[model samples]
Target: MPSLPTIVLVDDAAEVRSLVRLQLRLAGLGEVVGEGADGRDAVVLAAQWSPDVMLLDVSMPDLDGLGALPQVLEASPRTRVVMYSGFTDPALAEEAVRRGAVSFVQKSTDLDALVGEVRRLLPGEQPAAAPDAVPGAEDHDPRAAARELEQHVERFAGVFDDAAIGMATLTLQGRLVRANSALARVLGRESADVVGNHYPEVVRSGGDADGRLTAALERATRGDDDVVEVEHRYRGSHLRTTFSPVRDQRGRPLYVFAQCQDVTRQRQAEDQLRQAERRFRLLVEAVEDYAIFMLDPTGHIASWNSGAQRSKGWTAEEIVGQHFRVFYPVEVARSGHPEHELMLALRDGSYHEEGWRVRRDGSRFWAHVTITAVHDEEGHHIGFAKVTRDNSERHRLLEEQERYARALAEANERLERANHQLAAAAEDQAQFLAVTAHELRTPVSVLSMSGRTLGEHWRELDESERDEILEGMETSSARLQRLLGDLLTTSRIQASTLDLRLEDVELAAALAPTVDELRRVHVGAELRLEVEAGTRVRADPGRLAQVIENLVANAVKHGAPPITIRALAVEHSVEIEVRDAGEGVPVELLPRLFERFTSRGAGGTGLGLHIVRELSRAQGGDAWYDPVRTAFVVRLPASGPP
Candidate 1:
């Protein structure tokens, strides 16, 4: 039995060390002659123990397995180290390969694969090959030599006339002695015709007199070089021809062997690939505003050409294999936007959006992006291809323009409303001024005309005429006084300064005085007052008198002569109605009759009825017109507790 090879086990954990040692023992690989807890320990232990194979963990507290690999190799040149770690980081795997680590495994890798790796790295292990001892050797023991010669013959015959490339043999003088079927076919001749032909007869150009064939043949024959391949033309067709010299026992050149291969398809495919690459480069350059790139299956950037770097401000080295979340802002990153988008794309085959993305310096830019899932020919999703464009400037301009439009619309609406209010105010002011002037002018003209008449007719006037003139003067003076009183009362009412002197009084008592005043002012109207004598109400005296007087005046001036004032006691109030036997007010004007300046007659200030209504309301009473009876009614509180 062969001696057992020594093995070294290195791991950061003690359990993995025992587990691997047990497995290796069961597999009969070797005994664990050395152990290490870290990459540095592995390196030191390997130098001291000089084991046949060193197994090291790729990750450790100090130096990683990959980092310590070169030191271990330098320390013990013959020791073979195998790397293992829980990390699936491809960069680490690639680095392990680069540093000449013989094997790599994840911690949870299949036990069979782990055993296979350990066995492959074991020293003094030979591959299963043909046995060195030949069959039927017996006492002569020449069978091994005979078998080696047979193998050489079999290999030489097996490749001599391969189909893909044609082979043939020629003499030193360039005469063809033998040819394979493929070579005959290439020359457009039968084998019999090509076998005895010379190179000059077969080649369109006379045998490369440039001495290339001669030099190749000389090197092979003198054992200087084994084989030579030259690109030459035969029958005006390009051919890759290989030359080797066949020699005798004394190493003298017997024949020059040549093989020809057709490379047209391969060269054409290469040219097509080059053209495709050129078009791809042009396409990438033409898209100036977009960052287009590719990602590996694990969402790491795989390809970042010039266009991507220019648009995103990321160099190829900075972004490749790093998570795409680097492009998202911190808020977006924490929300897992980049990962969510990738998942959606993987499920749906695409994702598209426009939003803000962060740059390396932490500034933001608006981006329009399209992510398309990349797949193999069989439709298995392999990765993602992303195209992003910086649309920050255009987005900003559009938002600014929309805001301007909204502002302009608001300004126009405000201006229109202001113009309308100004027009309305102008009309109201003009109406008020015209009405005021007319009311004043009529009174002043009456007083002036009466005075002038008295002055002119004093000598001619008898006692009766003088009395009438004096009475006319008195009437005009009373009218002027009434006008002034109404004006002052309206002003007080508008300013909310009118004070009420409340008292309990009979409703009839209030109406009697106003009726007498109305008859004295105009004897033409026939007025009558009827009331329940003892029916009383609680109200302001001056204000109640003003209400009755205004109603009586309204009827006398605007209605026919006969007027009747009636009073009654209802459940909680006394109602006084002033009725006129006259043409009823126009139905259209009834709704606004009690409003200020809404009287029918020109002599009426119109404030009389408005004041009447407002005074009644102020005394905890109300006034309303009864259109059915051509009557206006005033209702006051009864003399009782509310």
Candidate 2:
């Protein structure tokens, strides 16, 4: 159920909701994750699940759909709202779309058409319901099939006058003998004005299209088995019209029934999706640094990019249909590690590691692999995007370094820095390798070189030179400590194990320790903290300080000093703003600035801002990067007197 496209059904009438649910289930259109009786419930359900489509009733008690339209969208921005009503007024339909609904659907529409409208808003192919009963020739009485067809048509006719889609009966000569009010509204005319016109004339297509439709109508009269699908333009609406002919037991031609649905918006959406898919396909095929491919939900290979072909030594044609487990070593496959990786990706959004992977030629290479779960806009977990880069050379060098460090461990106290850095990897080495390999490597190199320099040339170095090297060592050590703290906190947060003891905390005092530490470490940078008296917040004191320190460190690392930290009381909350006078975060990275492993192309573990946000939220607050002000802001529920 979690892998299904979800929908929220909202209506004041329980009967309407129940019937729609039945239709949706019968069509396998989507899962109704939530149901609501009024406009306020619509907003709450939208916020809770962020379903793909919302069927909103136009009239409800307390707050109507029109009033809830903006709120529901604000709560869940991806939800496509469809206004449902019993009225067929064009003005109301126009207003609903004007207020952000994707479409307006009349409640009187046949349930099948309503199902289609909902299906149109969601992306992907839908499963169609099989016909419940169809008379066979063996069992057919002369009137049996005809009676069955008429019974279906009779049911359709009951809703013909009020259905949202355009329905018409045309003569064998392609003339419209009848038109419904909905079709008339689409044509900007009354039903009386639209009827009795040539279908081609009413549609207003060019000569070529008219001739094609006329021929199609002539063919449609010959058999009921063929369906002629055509697009017709009237006013500004693009109607997707389908002509189905009715026949008797002897197969004599009968009137052609046409169903026309406005498909202008759907066509535009499909065009945009095609363009995006083309661009993405081009991008994927052009990447050659790693093997990037997609696996189906059940782990069968779905797509193979050029990078996959180059690195894995198999062309797309040879590899696209194989199971993704083929890339794993035989022992690993037998151990169920491939399935485990996929399970981890689905459960945690991604799985990353360094391990051996088999090539098509049966050779093994150490690979750094990341398998990320891909979800559609409807929040359905569709597949996994796996990226694998050959890291054999790096792994070999790391092994050599470890061996050399182990050999020299007892020789000199001066080699202590390298040993300490190596010891840092004794725990959670896989995690450290995945997240901060580059970051940790640089700092380790600095400390190693500084130790070797002093050890090899103690007599040649003067007092000032020795002090500068020692200061560099101090800075690198502090950096490693901070990165480790961030890693631990991030792990706790991601595992949902972080404990917060929240209370009234004075803003100025909580920040004093962090400020002193930064000032002492960065003597050349100016750091200012400003807060009005009596400013306080309801937050965990330790986590609050950690959040503040991380933001200041970001400013110090990524922006130019002087940096300022200001806490201001506003209404029932207190906002702590940390700002620097440097250029703000780039527009592209701003949207994902707080995401894990998101970097600004600067140095440090990418977990700082992510941890800051998580810690703030854990204590009933939130954090954001304000690109316009070049500041990182944290807002928390306020406490104490104003």
Candidate 3:
């Protein structure tokens, strides 16, 4: 018992393959070795199985049986190709035989009667290239067969001459013996001009084509290589040329047969695609405000862009290959937040968020981040594409705005309460105007008179007289400046625009200047300070000074002196009192004294006491008149030096 002849069946229809496979097996003529659905698989099957016989369909997707026939023969030279199809046209059989099939069998043919035919066409020694004869040439007379062979050779020669691709035959010594019109056109010359020139020189229009190609051609001519292919420039067009050596029966190399194709369009298209990809990559890498990059599967950083380097302070060389967790806070990474983001992206296709992200310098930024799961054509998750934008400035601005809003609301609440309490006294604002004019008049008159006296008396007065006049002017100027400052502060306090820098302010140290200034201005009055040692309050120093100044002015303008400034350190707060030895504010006026425009005497603008109360409250404290002690008191939150 001999081994069964092996067979491969190919068809677009599965039923046809099954029917043929079963019939061949039932006939006991061969064993079914492989199956294919189309011409692409037919070539692969030929290469893999090298079956005794291959039954190939005439038509299939991607490549047809007729198209795959030569490739099949090239892949498995010893195996026989039997063209199989539903159509019974005799011309199909003739065409198949011309392209190197051993036989053509219609599907309608009875398998019982075809076993002997299949056996006759099994594996056998054959030429490596396609056969030259048409089907049925063996059945004709010798002269008729000779004529048929001549016609076949003539038809092949015509195909060679008129083919779209360039074809030429060259002597093994490298001379072009013949070239098709297509070859001549590819070389940018007449057919006659291209036919006799050395192939490489003809390709470049005169110069030697390239050293590597010359070597390849030499190797092909020497039979050292079975096939040689190269891509090179020719006549300003890109081309790919293949060289194959024709050999005699004893395996001696003859002339070299070559095929050339004008791949200029394809090459140009490929170059354009590569350039577009390069430009896109550069664009992604150059962006600086947004960090755009890629991560591999399992969350390792695969690419880093310029924005990532700029914002996160990590160069691509340092960050790439590290895990994406490197961009997250240590606690966040430990909590598996980065991995959670990856998982969420995988589940949802994309994840977007705005939150804090860590930087290389240990600083943090408010980052708007997006992570998108990336997939290949087959839809397998490969990695993630991440984009992060630094939004720290915007975040900070939003917070500051919220703080201002809260401050405004608090100011409005306090203003509302004060308006309710002072509703009956709204008519008193008219008196406030009168008080401002009268207070403003005193300083303006003193300045005008002092200037006149100084101008006239400079030559007439002695040194003591001149000094006393200038002192009067300086005191009036200081008083005028303090009044203007009070006015501006009132405007800012009402506008809610006043800003403060709070710190541990020592009451004694901070008040020394204001007390000395008062001593100079009120030269005959006794002004004293009693500050407990190391006493401090939590307040803005400049604002605290304003509060003290207003209280002192209130005592001097309304109550009488000697004025006493005292600081007392309490358990959770500190107290500062401005007192005068004169009779205290009347009981009836005391209730309305802290109101913005309530007046005690004609000498004051009535804003000093209100400002004192408001400024103290703004620094987390309050002010009031302690009638029993005959003192105007400010109580502020206590503090210790840091």
Candidate 4:
């Protein structure tokens, strides 16, 4: 006899390697020299053993068979490699052939054929036919046919038991005829327990009696070409099932082939994604301060939000589908600044600048604009997301601050010269102290009168009268407290002692109590609050409350009734606005609204707005005025959850 060819087997599944080894030995076709469980080990074994032939599985963990093919051959140049796998694809076979694999065989091929192929590739091995046997003898022999069937059944059994995915075969009556270990584990039962049980009945007992599986089985068994698939929930587990019919020669169904996968985690992830999308949509729609919108590839407005309507003064129905350049001032639009911004965003992925934009009424306001490019998975530019905020008030305040700095420098220089005239300066300072004292005496006098009235006629006064007296006293007390706070805050500013204890605070929780207190203090003014829940800010809660109280109190004292307090969450910040239903402040006073002692009405020390702005700036935020709405708006750093 010719020398037996030595072979090595490589497969991820130990059972598969063992079966192939046993079949080769039983057929007396070759001698097994070594075995490996993955492609990396196969390369080392092939080089060590120097086998005549190597049977390598195509799909293995770490490095696949194709990836290892060139390396294996380079290591053992004399070894002829045969790529084998349960999955047969022409593309993979072609790739294997190109990579120096002598042949490709499906694991489902008959054992006799597989042995013959391996023998033919081995050195000095030639298959011979006996003189008594005619051509195609096995095709006509009953024994040969029976043996072939047995071998096929064995191969199938090996593959089914070792499959990584859950698989089963059911009879026409819906009874389980066979099940793999994977399927048994998915159902949390033994293979024997699942073999004879009805599949639909088992599913029903598992608390997922949706009848979908049964319907799928019925449809598949009716000689339909469509594969049936459905997601089923059973006993807190999510199963994705697919059903296909196994047909006989005449296209009549014989069995139902089914595959089940546990998709519970996948379903949960999808639900979370949907909920996040919903929250994002609500956040986009709820914003009313900044213009947040989308643009197409060519810079046309694709979508708009309520904030876009309020800021740009163009409703969605009118603005959408129009060029974003419409919002730019006439001169800026003519200069192609909008198009230039889009080009910059496309090139660098984002662009931001402060420029002039036009509202619908033809008025121009300074705006801070940002444009960001949006892309798909392949990095193809799809569109752009644009955000614009009315920064005119901020620009004005910056100019004022520069002027104030210059004036302070001049004053310091003058004081150096005025040290010689200290007596004259002392008189002016004394007069200033007297004016401050007079401002304090007003609220104190009101509080004393209200307290005396409530104490002297507690029972004699009617309920409405008593309530009015109590509200007046509370208002006066709040007034005094505000004055003292302002004085302290001013002193701290001069001494640079103002500090903040920044923390994550829910805007609604912080503002609700302030609104309630405002209603009690201003009983005659109708106070309405509209605030979004779960809006958080990074700021000191006590200082934030004081800012809100001062704004609302100013509305009550200067503006008319029906004052509205609105709070909205924007990108990177939270905005709170206090609006009243009255004619707005004089345009002349708007520029100096936040100046110290700048009051348009009586009973104010002109420090309320000034203190509000100072406190906001210390917390990495700022305060501004919306002259159109007569609203004082405060923007603060948002403390969104990490």
Candidate 5:
């Protein structure tokens, strides 16, 4: 029985060491003699176990596998070291090669390679780079060198087939001599099917232009270093080909090499980016309200659009390098607000506001402005994007509306005053109607009675008796004429043009005539006309006479006759009351009864009492109905005796 070669496994994890040990033993190459969890322990264990091969993990605590490789070799001089780790660090692998490591294998399921490397490194076999291992040297086996080269070719063939990029080789005549599985897949054909065909003919079958392929081949044949990107349609699908010239060391063309990759998705993205840029340009130019442009970091204008010329009166050629502060007034520029606003946008990415801006012609405008910082994909600040709108028209429209509103308010105030005066005039006309009705009805009643009586006694009377009766009728006729004159005076007050003929008149003297007139008209009721003898009021005598007559007449019509007319004179004014025995006014209606059309009497036109109220006021006094006493009071400014 031959003694089985000893194996030492090293890893930082127990599970990895256990699995590796199980796999190695299952392969029947060797039995695990010892195990270690770190590089240092692996080195110690190698010396202790004296294993034929030491499988060491490249990464460990305290000492990494590469650091412990020398220690493992020195401690166990006869033992072989094979680096086993998950990381494929080329630097670590090269270092192991320099440091006399037997071989390097990845920590994966390629356990056969592990056993093979171990078997090749066992004692009595020369190293890969032994001094006499080269062909044509002493003790060199030509058969062994040829066998090694064949194995290298087989391994490289598998690698070429599995490469990520498509690889192909063409002969000097542009024949597709050799092509990997990946290359065939890119061109949508089988590797064996295109082997004897010309490269251009195969590409033409796949929808690539024959002329483009031929031109590239010609360049490659001349050894001028041809390289190009070609697109081909294969199996109704698109493919991208990257072609490079393969040249010999003597500067002669050998074969053309081509690598193909799927650039369809990348090309689509670039097309989409171009379309998006086109749409953005259209949208920016279509904006009619904003003067959008770009500004360099120093606030110099960079580009201009149609809106810029329309809004700011500056064309692109004239303003491209001009400072943007030209759009600001002198005070605004002096305040450094424009520069500060741009700096803020540069710092924070966006700044927006509305303010007054100056145009190229020095005219000012209200502007809505925004400054946004443009940045690169890596977040480096580039410059500011500015957009401005001319809002001066809207501002002027608002000012016009405000001016119209102020004018409307003033007109409304004047109209309100005119309405109030018209209301007063209407009320005076109403009062005059009531007063005229009472004043004229008395004389009309007497003339009616006197003419009837004279007609009845004409046959019995003598000439003297008829003449005296006619003279009495004539006196009453004259009295009726005087009453009509007073009615005319109150109508002038309604037209808003009542003229006062001022005169010194005694209050008592004005009352006597009105009292006598009332007695004749309202004989069915008691009438009391009392005057404070020395009472006088300053006013138009004719107007005062009209005032006294109106008060007495109102007492007769609205009050029970035997209506008392009492006058009391004070320092500044005189008060006359027409006491009525009629039903007192309602509490709610008392205030409006003096207003025009406020009377509830059927025969009353509502203007009679309203006219008397206005007439009293026009004389610089006021008239009011006292609800408490059921009487109408007329206050008049005092006049001294004539």
Candidate 6:
């Protein structure tokens, strides 16, 4: 009669809103004047109608109920907003109440209770007094009241029959009084068949099911608690069962309301997780190439794998409680390197290094080690995981390669030296060709000139003139012959075929003819002979003579006047000295004095001194220069010992 207490319904599901509206009408509690499918529409409808009560769903597409709550209240100041949701979260209900919601209701609440709550909150509504205390309460029509009670019971029955969750009611004697279709389906039976059956006999126990059902039911019946829950298997299906006691008005337990949920998927997921952990343990234990282990925060060894036992030479029993620093060399351990590595790993999440590590026998091996910080789900550092690989073989190979590289470098240096020597020899050969041509041309020019002069002026010249011309030709011929002989001797020496006819001879006598000839040829230079008579030497006469000739000729070409030839006897040798009066060779050129192609000035060929040394040596003597005395001295083996 109070304008039917108009209401506005808001829900995302049209069916849910329709159900609530039907329940309200059937219970004779209120009239739903308007409806909206979402919170935004709900706000608009509440403003337009200014309904007495607004039943708003919490979760809706676009502009949820909480977000629209204040706006709706602002628009319709007198509207009482009730937040309702399928979620049974008490915190959400409390929050909604705090945010100006007059009340909160779960979508799963019995239709009678929901209707009663709406009716209680209706405008101008007063709480009903007890039937005995109310004036004229007994005068009400029995038929109408009976019909209203019947509709309430029918609505409750409708909800219970249509519920998606498995639900049933059990009497205090443990007999099923009523069962929903969902619960009957879970038990693979008809609702009528389940209603009369004993609960414990219908639901069988599973693995380790030691009277859990009887215990949970007994606890609920004894008033110890309103609800008792247990997870067990029934008919090969995992189920989570909750027993809630439904008490009478006097607080005596009347029935147990049971809820059963199929949790097979959840149980399967848990089983898979346990199996994965077991497989990981087996894998870690089987690995043997790398030392895999864990270290606690204080650097003590915590876990060790089979790989760790083989690689680090420590069994789990030996190393598990020990400090990780024992695996490091003494020097490394003393330097706090192990702790430093752990600190780095903790700070940066991981650290890696390749260095020396000690084994159980105190032998050292190069190892590549990795340390990774291990943390719990809350991100608190607990310890470190370490992986170590022996790299000693790689290190040895690297060292061997370095040694091979050094040896190759030394060989390259030797090859470079040989190449330099070859280049020098090529240069000397080129110089010899040029100098020999010049030396040969000088003698040929003299012969050509003397022959032409003799042929043209033979009759016109006097005897002395002819004799002088003939003598000049003879000298040129002899010079040509001597040059040819030097070339031949050099060839023979190179071939290692220069044979010496050894003989004993007086050294002074052997040098006398060479000196006289040199004196006759160089009329301007004076010759002095300092001879020690009876200075005998073992010598080849021709080769020794050639040595004296080349030395004297060198002195004649390079020295000033007063060339002195001295012969002396020394221990085990005869010393022949050709001295000149000139400053000696430059100190820088002294080392290469007897080398081929070494000449002070251009007139004489550079081969002279080189040939002199070779020929002197062939005759069992050696030729060398005296820098201090400006002398070329020859030492021949003495013919007779002193």
The number of clashing residue pairs in model 6 is: 1
**lDDT value, residue 156 of candidate 1:** 37
- The lDDT-based order of candidates, best leading, equals 4, 2, 6, 3, 1, 5
What is the clash count of model 3? 0
**lDDT (10s digit) by residue, model 2, range 214-296:** 56666676543335766755566666666765332123333456766778897787799799989976774576867888899
Give the TM-scores of the predictions, in the order they appear: 0.35, 0.34, 0.33, 0.32, 0.31, 0.38
Provide the overall lDDT of each model, using Cα atoms, as 2-decimal numbers.
0.67, 0.72, 0.71, 0.73, 0.66, 0.72
Q: Candidate 6's error at 53, in angstroms?
A: 99
Q: How many backbone clashes does every candidate have?
A: 0, 0, 0, 0, 19, 1
Order of the predicted models by TM-score, top scorer first: 6, 1, 2, 3, 4, 5
- State residue 23's C-alpha deviation in candidate 6, in Å: 99
In lDDT terms, how accurate is model 5? 0.66
**In candidate 6, which residue ranges exceed 4 Å CA deviation?**
1-363, 366-414, 449-453, 456-475, 583-588
User: Residue 374's C-alpha lDDT in candidate 1?
Assistant: 90
Off by over 4 Å in 5: 1-490
By the TM-score metric, which is better: model 1 or model 5?
A: 1
For candidate 4, give the lDDT of residue 612.
89
Q: Give lDDT for model 1.
A: 0.67
Candidate 4 C-alpha lDDT tens digits along 1-642: 666789999986553564466556644678898999777998999889888999987755455677778899999999999987544435456667877999888664233455667878876666733223334544455344344544644564576667776877664556564577898888888776655456788876787677887777777667353257777877789987776554432234445667777888878988997999899767755767578999999999999988889888888899999999888877888998889999999999999998878899998888878899999999988999998877765667556856997997899799767855763343323223323433443344344434433343345456876676566557557766776777788779657898878899988888889889888877888998888787789999999998988888788777898998887777888888889987878887888889765656454556788888998998989999987656888999988763
Off by over 4 Å in 3: 1-433, 461-472
- Give a tens-digit lDDT track for model 6, residues 1-642: 336878999976554565566556544567788999676898899889999889997755445676678899999989999888643445466667776899888654234445667878875655432222323334644334434534543564566668776877655656564567888787777676555456777785334256787777778666566457777777787877777654432344444667777888878988997999899767745768678898999999999888888877888999999999999989889999999999999999999998999889888888988899999999998999898878765567546755987997899799879969964553444335334533443344344434433343345456866676577667667766766777788789878899889888877787788778878877777888888888788888888878877877777677787888887778888788889887767787789899765666434455678898888888777899988777899988887744
| lDDT per residue as tens, model 1, 560-618 | 86888888788898888888888867787788889875656434456788888888888
Per-residue lDDT, model 2, residue 357, is: 93
Q: Choose 2 or 4, whichever is better by TM-score.
A: 2
Q: Better model by TM-score, 1 or 3?
A: 1
Candidate with maximal TM-score: 6
